[model samples]
Target: MGAGIAAAGLSAVNWEKMLQIAASWIISPVLGGIIAAGFLWFIKVKIIYRDNKITAAKTWVPVLVGIMGGVFTSYLVLKGFKTLIKLNFSTALSVGFVAGVAIWLVMIPIVRGQAKGLENRNKSLKKLFSIPLIASAALLSFAHGANDVANAVGPLAAIVQATKSGDYGSAVTIPLWVMVIGAAGISFGLFLFGPKLIRVVGSQITKLNPMRAYCVALSAAVTVIVASWLGLPVSSTHIAVGAVFGVPKLIRVVGSQITKLNPMRAYCVALSAAVTVIVASWLGLPVSSTHIAVGAVFGVGFFREWDAVRRARRQRSEIVAPLAMPKEERRRRKLVRRSHVMTILAAWIITVPAAALLSAAIFWIIQLSMR
Candidate 1:
């Protein structure tokens, strides 16, 4: 899309295509929110709030395996390598099956852990989810670097080609170094600008335990898969923030939070984010990973708060004397920090127009200078 836009001015860019992209900006986040919230509801009713969390947790383990395997496998098959690993539809399915089996194997011990010496045994078993969450984040990060690297290098490559060929339409070879520059840019961004934003996403929205984090990450992947199927033009980042979670928050691509993720959280978030990105690319919506990621965290935060409210109501009804609860405990859960969410939303809204205006100013300067 950047290459096309660079080769041709805005008039040359298809308005219909632009409209589709615009529609996705709205639809992507909404869709992502719905999917994520629905999944959380399922978890609460079936696992967290269920009478048999042990069995429920065990049951969901295999289902999550299928989800992760299928999502990642589809991602690899669709995107693994334009020039490297290739998997046809059937082959991809096979790989997914194998991954599912492997995940199940790993999950067994965690699910089957001895219930002895443990209070809230089901809660304890949930910790095993952190392992995959970390692994997924790593994969997401790698893919993000790969996909976004192209974004960084694309204009450079196009410019180089145009300069050499003296024609936007001419075929030209892309230098590998261009890609390296993009990757370097991402690494630099992470190293330099990541810390401040990581804190915002990690803790500000909600109290994210590993389980919630996993849901956020996994939902991002699932939404991308869904967007692909529906042929929607959603932003990569919107799906991420709406679909993904605090994992993206950790990597500095999404929201701000204080501490960095442990190795596991980092891994899962990055991998899931990358997969979400590739899926978005395949769908032709090269939306901002940062925006999507932030939205996803917000969605999770919002959902958590809603869930808390619902739980409170339920508990209140069951309690003989609801008024006996402490004042602090009686306070409504602030699942999401409204100020941060507003700030992030405002930034996303302004980004494109801000860039356009800046570009126009630069163009005006150039015209005066050339005169």
Candidate 2:
């Protein structure tokens, strides 16, 4: 959409915003996975692994529910209800805290009531999580609807507003019909097409009982909350899908794959990446810190390789001894992993064109339907 607008010589395309959204595509899912995995780990340690699983759940589930209530409330207030009221972070947090405590106090008896007759088995424990899981899933869907409906309708609204007013670069006013169309389309599509995807994400990827499913749902919601706090516009669908699937170790591109990173080398990469991004942003360049950081790591790795080769030659000239480093050690000493470089390059190469083609196809379909 941005590309099409730019091609038409419209000033509506915000390149910096596009770059930030692209960066979020990388950052958000990873954070979702990490948060989900961590939540799963916590549940395993605190509840699942305990001898008295029911007792453990009865003790902790209320607290978790309260936290979720708080986070969800804050997210809805700050992101979902933005037009109604503008809230500062401190005010939002305070509101969240009060809501959380209220939820905690209310849920204590409810959870206790639910858990009262349950057995100490894992199956019984799963039963305890069903309510929270269902609630979390509903909340997640609500958040997705709120965020993505705007995205779906925004361009259409802009085009309508622009065509009606003959101003292509003005603030867009979304009509009531546009909102209804976006909502109805999403609803019908999801109703007709969502089950297959639900099955795939809910079960095909991994077995999920209420307990595990709750963790994933809550993790996704919490991740979006954190991203909101950090002021990043992330895809809720991406976050939920990532929570259901797994997190990738893509950050290793700069931290490890390019070279062995000690504290000093890691610090250098971080500082250089930060400075490069700061400067680029100040200059209004759409530069990605991810790319800059990876390049810095490669630079450091190549310098280390050159230094090692030079030292090896100097040692050889001083004394013609047998190979000081074993062949295996020498092989291990290769700084950069070529496979990592190639894989990263291949992904970078395909990402833009693939996304553009998909966007074009969807836009075409929408245009045809409208006509």
Candidate 3:
């Protein structure tokens, strides 16, 4: 009689808890998206328009692709991992981390070459635009922090519920530390390794005016925010990359230098990255947004001779100055490059597992301590 009574109580508690978990899963992303969208809109109308610039036409195309792509990729990947591994959160986290590292190693060289080629082709923008770029980067970072952090925290919330109620359906307040760690890890990834990818996005995939880049960034942020508000999981990386490509295409369509535009190459890269994410997720590997974005940029860069053509147009004197560097300085530069490569590799390898391990360990310890 006592056992029957206890089981009935447990079931009742679990049912109530499920409602809470469902509510949270629905609300959190919406809140995150609202915040992202509001900030992006503010930047667009107040800052971007103040400069008398407009985003390229058909900008929505890439923004839509990114939103759809991110949502689809994330859903499929998460679902596949659960189906294949049947592992606990801890094991899955570690596995995902290893997979992310592997993807990074393969992507870096390709992205670097693309960045260099893009730089070679485009005349560097005047320094005046630096402030706008920095601001845009901050906006990108904020959107990333809001959305991606949710990805890290979502499982933790589930684990906490499982531990506390001995059920999977409870909702618990997310701790400050978890938020801090996720934000920090993402910031570290952006600050230390983001510049390379940024250069690729900013310079390599397409030459963007500050106004154009701002529009692209604004469009991506806005789209993500809207999706998030609707509880949609979207890819900020895809949106940003798409925005970058969209501008060049727009310029071409209006009978501007269409010959220089390479929509086929851009589309190919984007498709490959999407396919890669799907494959990786299916294999239960957690891939990085950074990696996918970088790979896409690299793919577009490798198939063209635009760089060689651009180099031919520059003054010969400018090319010779870099070669005149002192041997020691050149050696130092090489060392810096190698170190950057290694650091990026380490971050990629460690992120998923580290987050998972941290989450699991925290949950386990809390359970023990509470008991």
Candidate 4:
């Protein structure tokens, strides 16, 4: 579409914006995975792995609910209802914090009530997550509609603007009716054809308990909000799929296989990466340094193991063994299906160029027919 428009002298392509979007396509999923894994780990350590699970849930679930409430409140104020009202980030954050505290106070008794009859088991814990998970899912759906509907109607809006004014600028005000149509079309299409895809994503690829589903839903919502704040275009599907893949197993693989990370080491990596990026930016360099952080992790892991072996050899002593899981057990414990991952990756790779080519072809045909 950009190609056709440029060829016809309709609009100049903003390659920089395109680059930002392409970068987002990569970053959003990784960010979602990181956030989801981090949140899930916190839940496990604070609540799931506790001796008194009911007690822990009663204590922590309200806090988690409050956090989610705050995020959603801030997001709505900042972006969701931007058309109806305007607010700055600081004000939005302030509102969110106050709302969050109120929610925390309200949920305390609710959580306690829910925990009254529950057993100290993971199954019983699922009940605690049910309400939050549903709310998160609803928030994710709203975010998805807000973000992806623009993708659907954006080109049509541009064409309408160009046809009316013959000035296809980078920005155009989308008509209200156009938005309604886009949203309605999305809902209608999903109602007709969404179930098969949902089945594949929901159950075929990986089985999701309420806990895992909550993480996936919240991660996707939070990722979309963050991406919107940064003016990046991201796919909700990608973020959700990435969150689904960001289970405890991935953390185990990274910590056990690539590197063993204590809290201090993890903090070091995060801080060093931030410092490096700040320095690079100060020096007037544009850099994406996620790979740099990853390299540091692997480098630290290898160096430590080598140093341990060297000291062991010099002292004629045994080196401490790394944690190990049996291969069969590991296979059985795997949460992600490799086949689905490969299929999804293949679709992602093919979809972009194919869609662009098809759009270009259709545009040319339309032009020819009009001529």
Candidate 5:
């Protein structure tokens, strides 16, 4: 959520870049949905109904492997060898592409052999992808750390620079204390709140098996990579959490809320919020990052609720699926916990306003004292 809001702040800094990112975010999922559905159709036509189990697995495995290869290769190219080698961006991209293709080709033989004669090959498809999924998650964590550690370093860097040079725009030197504090603060935060955040994300927001978790992590990594390449500021944390709200909202927390979170549609939720707040900020509105994130979360969910109600109104519309599962059916299987939703919504409602008002009062008091 913190990351989401910070990314939103970039719109205030530069709406043109932010909106361009907004376009990418919008197109990515739409195109992805079309491509995925088409791929599924292709499999049904070319592989699945044909009953050639051996060929099905072999064909799909390479595609998945190649995608994974491309993702990690791109990540490594961007940041993997900066300390060891200082290749320029284009060189790094070339190296990464070659590495990805090599890996994809190498995996074909391995995955082909592994998929031989499983009774439930379809169900086990994700199982075949499991190792790669875990690898992607690991890569994502490293990529996230590489990118998101900047959230801590950025303000500190600028502050240190300003204190020394009396100019916010000066070149900055990172002090040891700043580095220690940033690392220690993150460590402490993870120790303290990490478990709960992990629990809420893994168990509540979405049902996370190894495969689904890979979806969240992989999507985040790819999104962040795109953001970086575009020079857009983003928070990996926000993107990950936002990605969860995209699709397959399942309850996994034992005894918390069996209620469902088909609460929000997968596409358009995260980017919509970011773009909205960004446009507002550009118009000189004083918006809070926390507010934008929480609002986006709720707004998306509520939109889903409304979609459930209105899904039957139009038959030929592409915007809202008229053929989507009926709202009542969705309500039973995918009910969102009212308490869980409201608690965050309530906090989002007040936190920013209260903080701003209190700070204003304190500053006024100090001014009077000086007078």
Candidate 6:
């Protein structure tokens, strides 16, 4: 009798796992793609392109194309992982993380080359060349979806696998439905909370002319892609932030123009987010990507503005009109000021815990229901 009961339970487990994977394949990608598209659209229309006619139109086209490309890249990466590595969840996650960092480090030079190429093409048009940025953003998004998408679906996959194998285990085949939910969650996160961060990133950190923006975006994307290919689970936020900072650093080093670069502020923001992630992981809590990315943006902005403030003060002492700078330059300076940083920082501090707690709660509820 005991043997018979054990056999029956094992059979049930296997069936459940199969069902879960089946569901996930059907749902996650579609949901993720749609949500990402909608959220990106909002950013283009409401914030980035708000009043600019030419920029807005060109921006949207790339964004739409990039999102689609990202979705496809994500699907391919995940499917490849499933087919190839066959590692358990913990191992896979570890591998992914390391790979991501390595990728980012290696891509730095390539990014420099791309930036140089753009500069050579047109000095004035260099700032407005956003095409490369959009392309790069798309790639980063693809890698992001490929690696992190697992986070949303992994548990469900485990649950399914456990059910099918008649053993409670961590590694399980992800089902279609679970994939859909995870993808949907990501999409929702991007749509609802992504814009503010995007604004901070796209506009605040540095005055990204189209060309500069393209360089940053492309470098970041390439970093993520290489990482994903290496099976690394790196943070898209980190890559995006790093690339944003990296571009300016490259410009200063290569261009040698004394344009202000705020390393301190950028470090603070990136460091804070990194610390938060470590703490959260240690404490068994989920950290928000949006929080970290936004924090970095604010950091760069604050330091830039702080430098500007000092410049204004020095000018005042010399009896020169502090407000004599070009309106565009002043506007850029104001955007980076300390006050703006604080506001954005406050937002970042709030988003992570809130989103994580919400996700955890929802996950718990779902588990309980399934039980």
- What TM-score, computed on C-alpha atoms, does each candidate reach? 0.75, 0.63, 0.35, 0.73, 0.57, 0.40
- Model 3: worst 10 consecutive residues (lDDT sum): 253-262
For candidate 4, the per-residue lDDT at 87 reads: 89
Clash count list over all predictions: 39, 0, 0, 0, 2, 31
lDDT of 4 by residue, 57-145 (tens): 88887887687777778777876678899988799889989998999999998888888878788778877776766666565566556
lDDT of 2: 0.55
- Candidate 6 lDDT over 209-275, as tens digits, reads 3433332332223333333444323332322322334433322321112122222222222222222
Tens digits of lDDT, candidate 5, 246-342: 2122122311232222211211222222232222222222222223333333333343344445543444365654566666766654434566655
> Which portions of model 2 show Cα errors greater than 4 Å?
2-6, 9-15, 80-86, 225-232, 235-352, 358-371
Q: Write the per-residue lDDT of candidate 1 for residues 290-326, one digit (tens) a residue.
A: 4444444555556666776767867887876555545
| Candidate 3 per-residue lDDT over residues 298-330, each given as its tens digit | 323322233333343354446554334456643
Single out the weakest 10-residue window by summed lDDT for candidate 4. 275-284
* C-alpha-based local distance difference test score of model 1: 0.54
Top TM-score model: 1
Tell me the spans in candidate 4 whose CA falls farther than 4 Å from its real position: 2-12, 81-85, 235-326
Stretches > 4 Å off in candidate 6: 1-123, 180-201, 204-206, 215-292, 295-335, 347-371
Q: Using alpha carbons, what is the TM-score of model 5?
A: 0.57
Model 2 shows how many backbone clashes? 0
Collision count of model 3: 0
Q: Which 10-residue window of candidate 1 scores lowest in summed lDDT?
A: 258-267
